[model samples]
Target chain A: MIVVKFFGIARIKFKEKELHLEASTIKELAEILAEHFSVKPKEFKQFVILVNEVNINKLKMFRTKLVDGDVVMFLSPASGG
Target chain B: MERLTEKTALIIGCGGLGGYVIEELARVGVGKLILVDGDVFSRSNMNRQLMAKEETLGKNKAEVYMKRLGEMSTCSVECHTHFLTEDDADLFERADVIIDCVDNVDTRKLIAKLAKAKDKCFVHGAIEGEEGQVMLVTPDSKVFDKYYKSVDDTIRHSTYSYAVATVGSVQANLAVKALTGKGGKFENKLVIIDLESVFVKTIEL
Candidate 1:
């Protein structure tokens, strides 16, 4: 299971702190999450996805493969000052 | 600390995070400060802004902080009583470090681009409710684009005093480190603070 977490506005929107899911890649995870949370798949684009505390963008992005026991976080940018 | 007396920091915005950043920079002896913010203090800002007080209501944020810091510190503080735009590009050239404490995403993107163009270290800070994020962007880093590319500026996020102060302090710390040649660790990394969960973590960007 991949341990998924949400932060900032994503947390507020999902109303869930964390969840455990099974997925092979970030793209698959996003699809599952979008369906489970009742949001559009495109909404995940607004989040910075991190796997094991490293941004997926620094890796292969949505195509990055997930592994068991990996920690994933979806974080939205905080624009307020 | 003595070395800080010769460094300059240019800060954009004088609201919640900006207020704390200015206070910290002033107290720590940053020799010069360039503050820009056209907005004035209002009743709504009293809850989070450090310089926003009853006496400062209706006063221009930049000007008010200039006067407040001038009286308390020996640092030379200059302010532009207007919002930053492309015309303010020259201001970035004059400072050793640039800070973004703006409330809007468009302005933050502009600052990031300007700082990158000028090869200046940019310290970005923002707070929403119980969460805040601080990132140090070196001239070559593309962290801003990666983090804010999909952010919706039309949406406003609620901010609190504690989150503002915490993030602002972290921003100041990064600025000081950049000025003092000790900020390599922060490059390409984003620090996220969650007051509700009481945890602070750094994610490699």
Candidate 2:
């Protein structure tokens, strides 16, 4: 099972907030988010995806694959300067 | 009397927050002025920009800043009206204080890096909805470079309201206090303001 966390405003939109799923790829994980939460992937694409508390954008961001029990975090459109 | 009186200030962007910075700086008697921006006034900017007016639409930001500040004081004013990135390291090295008024985080991060590399004091500000935060950092802190490791350079958002105006004022105010050294301020921390509830909180990094 893979764990997904949503933060800031995105958390407000989710029913269970964070989820645990059995997805293995970025595409599959996103699809699972849509299916489980009834959300559109397009609207939340810009939100940063974090894996294990590290930004996916920095390590192997965006297209980074997911593994079982991996932790995924969805950041809001927050401006941190 | 464009003589250097106190310290110099470099304002990175002349949008919503930049305009207020200029107005407040002019009012407080900053020693020198450096205004940098690349775009012009559009209809959308008219809502919250302190310097934006109906007649100034389509005018280059640099030109408008120079012309607007010109009316306020005889202090020194230099307007670039262009973009500043790591490539503009010389500009980064020139100022005593920097106030970031740009809209995007990528631009803010780039400026913050250049400022730290030059060992200059960097003041940051951002506004969204009725929420905004102001932070002050030097080469020593990891507020921007360390904390924001995930923000994509290409990602951008378009949000505006009186909240941006109020929150942006906090940024400008913090910048002024950093320049002139007035009021209680944040040097290594950020003050987040929720204008909707009129609540203020500090987030220390």
Candidate 3:
């Protein structure tokens, strides 16, 4: 099980701030959210995913494994000055 | 002037964030500064850009900050009228700290990488609408990649004046603390603010 949190645009679209779900990897987690929310999987790919306070990109991209009590946050890029 | 009088800083971008960051650092007497920006002051910039005065309209942003810093402090201000790049890593080599006032995440990554390589403190700040965030990245920390995660490459946002000032002030404060050995609280954390709801959250990474 993992706790998934959303920020910025993801937060606005999901309507819910966070959710708890069971998943083994970030790819599975994102796929689950895409199905539940009716959003395209490609859109999910664009999100910056962080697992347990560490960026998934720093670990293993979407294949990073998740365990119970892990916190995953989805964030969008900001480019304003 | 107590602790910052001899410190040098590199400010990337002379727009909204840079305007306030430069002013705050100068006021606190950061004795050396490198101002980089490849923009001109347009009428629209007057709203939140502290240095974008009507009289200075059409003037180069970096030059504007250079003149303003010169008038406000005895800091040796060097103006680079272009965007920062890997080639500009030389600029960071001599600075005590680097401030990320640029709008894009790619540039922020460059600065953060250089700061880490040079063992310099990287004070990061960004604003979008009424929301803003500040973070302190030390030599060994990977906070930039952790928090941003290439978000700038895919998302676009606009900023507001209050958020810029608020976040820029925090950036300056962190820079001061890091430079003066006062210690930084956001080294492995990120402080996020939403002025619309008056909400602030600190995330420990």
Better model by lDDT: candidate 2 vs candidate 3: 3
Model 2, runs deviating above 4 Å = A1-81, B1-4, B153-158, B180-185
lDDT-based ranking: 1, 3, 2
| Root-mean-square deviation of Cα positions for candidate 3 versus the true structure, in angstroms | 4.0
Give residue B201's error in model 1 in angstroms. 1.1
* Models sorted by TM-score, best on top: 1, 3, 2
User: Which is better, 2 or 3, measured by TM-score?
Assistant: 3
How do all models score by TM-score? 0.94, 0.70, 0.79
Which residue pairs overlap in candidate 2's backbone? Answer: A56-A61, B37-B81, B37-B82
Q: Which pairs of residues have clashing backbones in candidate 3? A: A77-B151
Model 1 Cα lDDT, one tens digit per residue, B1-205: 9999999999999999999999999999999999999999999998899988889999999999999987997699999999999999899999999999999899999999999998999999988778999999998887788788776573466777899999999999999999999999887688999998889998886
Residue pairs in clash, model 1? none
Best by lDDT: 1
**Top TM-score: which candidate number?**
1
Listed in order, the DockQ scores are: 0.72, 0.12, 0.37
At residue B37, candidate 3 shows an lDDT of 93
